[model samples]
Target: MHDIDPGWAWSPVEESQQPWTRQLAAHLYRRAGFSATSETLDEAANKSAAEVVAELVDGRTESEEYLAQMKQLGRTVVATGNVENLPAWWMYRFLTTTDMLREKMTLFWHGHFATSGDKVTDPQLMVDQNELLRRNSLGNFGTLVAEISRNPAMLIYLDSVTNRKAHPNENFAREVMELFALGEGRYTEDDIRELSRCFTGWEIRNGRYRFNRYQHDSGRKSILGQEGPFDGDEGVAIVLDQPALPDFIIGKLYQFFIADEPAPPAELLAPLTIEFRENGLNIAPVLKRILSSQLFYSPHSVARKVRSPVEFSVGFLRALEGSTDQYALTSGLSELGQVPFFPPNVKGWDGGRTWINSSTLLARSNLIQSILKNKNTRFSNGTLSDLFDKHRLNSSQEIIDWLETMLLAVSLPETVRLQLQSKIDSGSGNREERLKEVVHLICGLPEYQLS
Candidate 1:
């Protein structure tokens, strides 16, 4: 296998005449956004890999109307005081929004930061944090870390608001080092204690950040070999300055976007980490490198991750070019063990193979079927058969191939492909029923579980 080039930043790979094949476009979409639509695949097939990466990174934007709608929905949720509905609302945006990459990164950061509404219990605060993450999702990492440190949802969730001069709560401090910035074993107990002291008096007042002067510990402290009378924000900055920070973040990004089971070795990530740090922790550049790198298109990285429930549910709907009740999708995702605002715990959902179990797998299948069965699900601006008519895909074989391209990340075995083709050919109903049957079978397969 070809190793990822260290100079992948500016070096464009040689482009073939057919550079943007359906397979490459599908891989790009699955990793960078959700799965590709037929329209997106068609458009991308005409562009080079570099152009596709650039556009996926910078071309998309959320519309003002969508922003207004999201604000209204959030206001409604906040007024109702049911923070639980935030996930359902987010699913609505995910289903309809044009800016897929932003939403995708927001989801990634949600998992990376791993704060839950279960702890905060304020709908508005959770909504605020979600927006903060989205705004800075592709922005600078340093600013994001500093802002998240003071985010009301985070302060409450990690007990940082309770951290004070006399009695310091180390939960937030420990997590900042352990989970957010640096991985475990990179910091000491002394670091956690000192960082907690630095964060003293950082409290939430009427749903906003308030630093209580009386509760603050003003004494000098030493953390990570630096001594100062540092505040919470400064502490975050100091931690971000650590040399180990880049490797920790890059590895996690690799796990999320590339392979997960057999973690990428440190040697493979060293060059990328340098680029990440040199670029001032702006995620877009590193992402551009990864998405455009030779290693990304290699067999070792493709189809290497299991789709999170959100990915499976949202990507499935997007692929069908269909729409459904967001409430149903939300409930179905919950059954699959991932609610948007409500991650199971601080560590968030354990993805990968843990996404699939006996019961959850059943729930996944039922959810896809329910979406397909929805009366409002239109393909090609009409019914499912309209999809066939619009695409000129009439035969059973062409329909199967199209569905496979849209749905499966991994290749199906020849025997399994033959069996599915047989099933489609043997169907008694018309093209719609045959298409649905073939698609349903494909979704239920193990291959579809992987991204």
Candidate 2:
């Protein structure tokens, strides 16, 4: 409930407690939310790992507000039958929202339980699903999965209504195990078939979920070694109780928050698993444990993952003033791969290496330049230096420092810095023109794109 204090920044630190800690925190902050500004970096670095985590949860304020907003947004959206230009909507949200965390986590859930607007074709369903994810995103994995399974958007996307006792569709059931809950190979084909039968009556009608009691078999079936005439909820319960389910869920958190590699040995996973099971699957405790863990900051984990395009674009937005028009910026993000709710497929975009291909990289470079020039979204102060100037940035050195601090918080090569200064000096322009070239260059480079 605390309003953001403009004065909040990291305390001045004399040195690193662990050199690797700085890198790990930066990586996690960017991945979990947006990119670092000089301001956010000050807030994130040199704190107890637990303190660093406070920032991730900082974005939670808008969930309650967003719930109300979504109701209005949804009603207006449905009556008009608006097929949202996904990028433009997201662009506006990214700039205007106090619920950046909600929006950001909603993004995570969209990918984790992948769906398609192409299939659902209802923006209300999409908007509704976004709320489900925001509410439960860092709350409960088990409940989140159950809610997602029942969601109208997902039901339509995965063909749940087609599921029947006589000839059940396995699409939703199979994915619940392979993709959503149990990951791969944990549940058998029979389990999926039986699970689909339990869910036979569950259907989306006029944007509501209905259970057709006459259609549901309510028959006993064996799933994960548990035998029952399990209905949808019971099927979900059986799947949740799987031994691999905790590891699967925790492993996903590891990949999302820690690293792309496998999770730590059983020693590290067991406590979080127990916390998940005991805490009614509230997710913050598990995430808190991971962020505070020594393993998270180990050298092997630092800089091991790449920023998803959304993160990259959001980071760019955060690096500037909150009022910056991101429509132009996100237009570039759309071209690169990520376009908020509009992912490339049912499986979503493969982040990490998939985000760094030849065409995508060029898009990244050009996007930085485009955004700096206000070519994508018109900027009140389109030039980067004016953004700097609005904050009263003076001197080429100060401008360079601001870019390094805000846009590229990580260390830049001195050679690159010198070359940038040379390029700026040779250009016959004011401070805006001079600093724009340097800020643009930093974002356009491979190093900026990498993390």
lDDT of 2 by residue, 341-416 (tens): 6766666666767788888878887876666666444333355555665657666566666666555425678888
lDDT of the structure predicted as candidate 2: 0.67
lDDT of each: 0.84, 0.67
C-alpha-based local distance difference test score of model 1: 0.84
RMSD versus native structure for model 1: 2.1
TM, every model: 0.95, 0.85
Poorest 10 consecutive residues by lDDT, candidate 1: 9-18
Best by lDDT: 1
Model 2, 176: alpha-carbon shift in Å? 0.4
For residues 380-427, could you state the per-residue lDDT of candidate 1 as single tens digits? 567777877778887767877888889888788889888888877786
For model 2, give the 10-residue run with minimal summed lDDT: 4-13
